[model samples]
Target: MVVEIVQDKEIWDRFIDESPYGLIFHKWEFLKIVEKYSGYTLYPCGVFRGDILIGVFPLYYKRNMAFKAIFSPPPQSGIPYLGFVMSSEYNGLKQDKKEVFLNQVVDEINDYIELASPNYVSISTVSNFIDIRPFKWNNFEVVPNYNYVIHLDEDLDSIWNGFKKNLRKQLSRPEILDLRLVPSEDMSLFYNLAKQRYEEQGLTYPIYSIEYLEDLFRVYPNHLRLYYLYYGDDLLGSITTQEYKRYILWMGNTRIPDNIFGNEYIIWHLIQKAKEEGYLNFEITGANKKNLCQFKTKFNPTLEICYNVCRKDTLGKLAETTYQKFVRKAG
Candidate 1:
């Protein structure tokens, strides 16, 4: 087996499109956007056995005066998870064979890591890529995060019946029903609301700039959806969703107060839209946050755990500890 940098976009994206574990986050175009907006250098690597391509891993390199780091699906890019995109051949392998193949991939990754010699390396694997034991064995720190996924293949009535009573009540409210669900191009409004939300929580706003969002919309128009809840001329809230293989409720911002319950209305509308669109799953990403978990649980979605793997050198470890301490104190 040999691993080398893949420069051909068609080859890279073909593997991603064919893999069951692939996501929109792993697409070549998305990585270009990430690199362009975040100003990070991208390394697109491919592993081949003999002459056949078997795996692809994309890494972003970041450097500062203090440290150098590499991330797979880097932070603040609206990407939930991305690590390795393996071929379908690996997917069908028996457990023992799968382990052997995975180890080979890890070996290649380790070789690249040694050559790059970054202070830190972090990778978040897709939801379906659950065989992260190889990474664990390699001394990477593993952190578990939760996401809520509603299986949308079932009958709509059955799905609706699964919602909590209060959620159902909120969805049924006449005021909510009267609000129009309209497609929106107002990213500035979305950014302002998101900024206000972060300020309200006394935390720094983490979203990318309006320019970045606009560029993302331009690049992946079919994959992205932006919707707003409006009562005639008054905008109440906005929700952004992405459709890859499944529907994902990526981010949302609301101008309406809690008592107004505009969020419930907008979410319900999106859920129904997902059902109509024949998506097999609707994911409410990042159910790890306390308040978010509570709110998303009202829909009776299944809990899915995703993994973030990190490996750091001495300096990187110290930096991580200091960052954690600061966050704890701030919280």
Candidate 2:
């Protein structure tokens, strides 16, 4: 088996397309956009046996005066999870064979990491790719992240029936009927609203530029949808949904305060849209944020836990500890 940097888009994306654990974020174009916007150098590696590609992972190299590290899917990229994408053929492998193949992949990755010699490395894998034992064996600290996903295979009525009473009441409100979901190309509005939300939460604004979002919309128009809720001329809220295998309620921002419940209404509309499109699942991305998790829980979605593997060398670990202390003090 040999591992090398994969420069061919056809080869890289073909494996991702064939893998059930693959995501739209793993696409070559998406990585290119991420690199361009985040100013991170992308290192995409492919593990091959004989002449066949078996596994692929993309790392982003981030450097600053305070730190130098590599991330599978870097911070503030709006990517939920991305790690190794193995070939679908591996899915049919026997348990023992699967373990062997995974170890080989991890060995190759370790080799790459040694050559790069970054201060730290972090990798977050999708929920379906549960075999992270290889990473754990390599001394990486594995942490779990959770997401809320509603299986859409059931009838719409059954799905709606699962919602909490208050959520159902909000969806049935007469005022909700007045709001129209308008699909628009105006990403600047979405960015501004998202920035406002971050500020309201006392957090830093996201690093994504408006140009980057426009590029994403241009590249994957069908996969990315931006909708604004409007009551005639008054804009109430905005949400972005992505259709990549499953429907994801990617990001949302609302001008309406918590008292108004505009977000719940918009999410309900998106859920109905997902059902109409025959999507297998509708995911409300992060189920870890306190208030956000409470809001999503009202929909009665299943909780899916994903894993993030993190590792840092001695000095890197010290630096991380100091950084955390500084952040706590600043907060």
Candidate 3:
């Protein structure tokens, strides 16, 4: 098998869409947007066996004089995960065959990484990507991340019954249940609200700007959306949901001290809506945040584990530590 950088958008996107392990963040257009906004070059690499494709990896590269870095999904892109994903056929292979196929793919990826020789490297894989052994074998530090995913196969009553009592009590109100999480192309509003929330919490904003979001929404209308709830003319809350095989609560809905039920109502509504639309799962992204976990746990979704693989040389380690210790604080 050979690893080659894929230039055709259609071919690259088709593979990602077909893979059960692929995510919206792995799509070609999404990567292009991130590349444009983050000022990093994106390399959509595919592992091919004969004439067939077996694996896909969306990698980002950046250089600053002698220092360089590589990332999948890159940092501060508001993307939870983006690493290599195998083709659908791999999922059907026997256990031994799966290991062999994965080994070959990782070998090629490692070769490419060696050729690039970045000072630092990071790759965060999707929750379903459980076989990260190849990366571990290559001496990449493995870190586990968490997410909450609700299997939509269960009945509405059964799913609701699983929720924490406090969450259920908040959503049980007739007024809250009757309110709708309306979808719209209001990019400015979503960005402003999200940006303000981040500032209020003393955290840096995630996405680049409204233009970045607007482009994504326009390009992938079917995949991403902005949904908001209203109390008369006042905007109670808003959320961005990502739709593919799984309906994901992608972003927004930061706590509004006054509108306590806004987020819970939206989440419950999305769960029922996703199930009704025949989606297999509903993922509440970023379950690692301690403060956010309190809200996410109330829904009682299954805790899912993902992995982040990283490697840095001595110089890279020193630079990162220095930045964390002094430069970041100085800024």
Better of 2 and 3 by lDDT: 3
Candidate number that wins on TM-score, 2 or 3? 3
Give stretches of model 3 more than 4 Å off: 174-178, 322-331
Q: What is the C-alpha lDDT of each candidate?
A: 0.83, 0.84, 0.86
lDDT, candidate 1, at 82: 86
Model 1 agreement with the true structure over 103-190: per-residue lDDT tens digits: 9998888788768788889999887567888888888899988888999989989999999999888877776656888987778888
Model 3 pairs whose backbones collide: none
What's the CA RMSD for each of the models? 2.4, 2.4, 2.1
Residue-level lDDT tens digits of model 3 in 1-331: 9999999989988898898888888888889999999889998999999889899999999998998899997776888888998899999999999999999999899899889889999899988678899998998999999999999888999999999997888887666755667889988888888877777765657677789889989999988988888755567778898898899888775554444577788888889889999998999988788997988899998998899999999878987797666543422
lDDT of 1: 0.83
TM-score of each: 0.92, 0.91, 0.93
C-alpha positional error of residue 184 in candidate 2 after TM-score superposition, expressed in Å: 1.1
Question: Where is model 1 more than 4 Å wrong at Cα?
Answer: 321-331
Error of 1 at 202 (Å): 3.5
TM-score quality measure for candidate 3: 0.93
Quality of model 2 by C-alpha lDDT: 0.84
Worst 10 residues of 2 by lDDT: 322-331
User: What TM-score does prediction 1 earn?
Assistant: 0.92
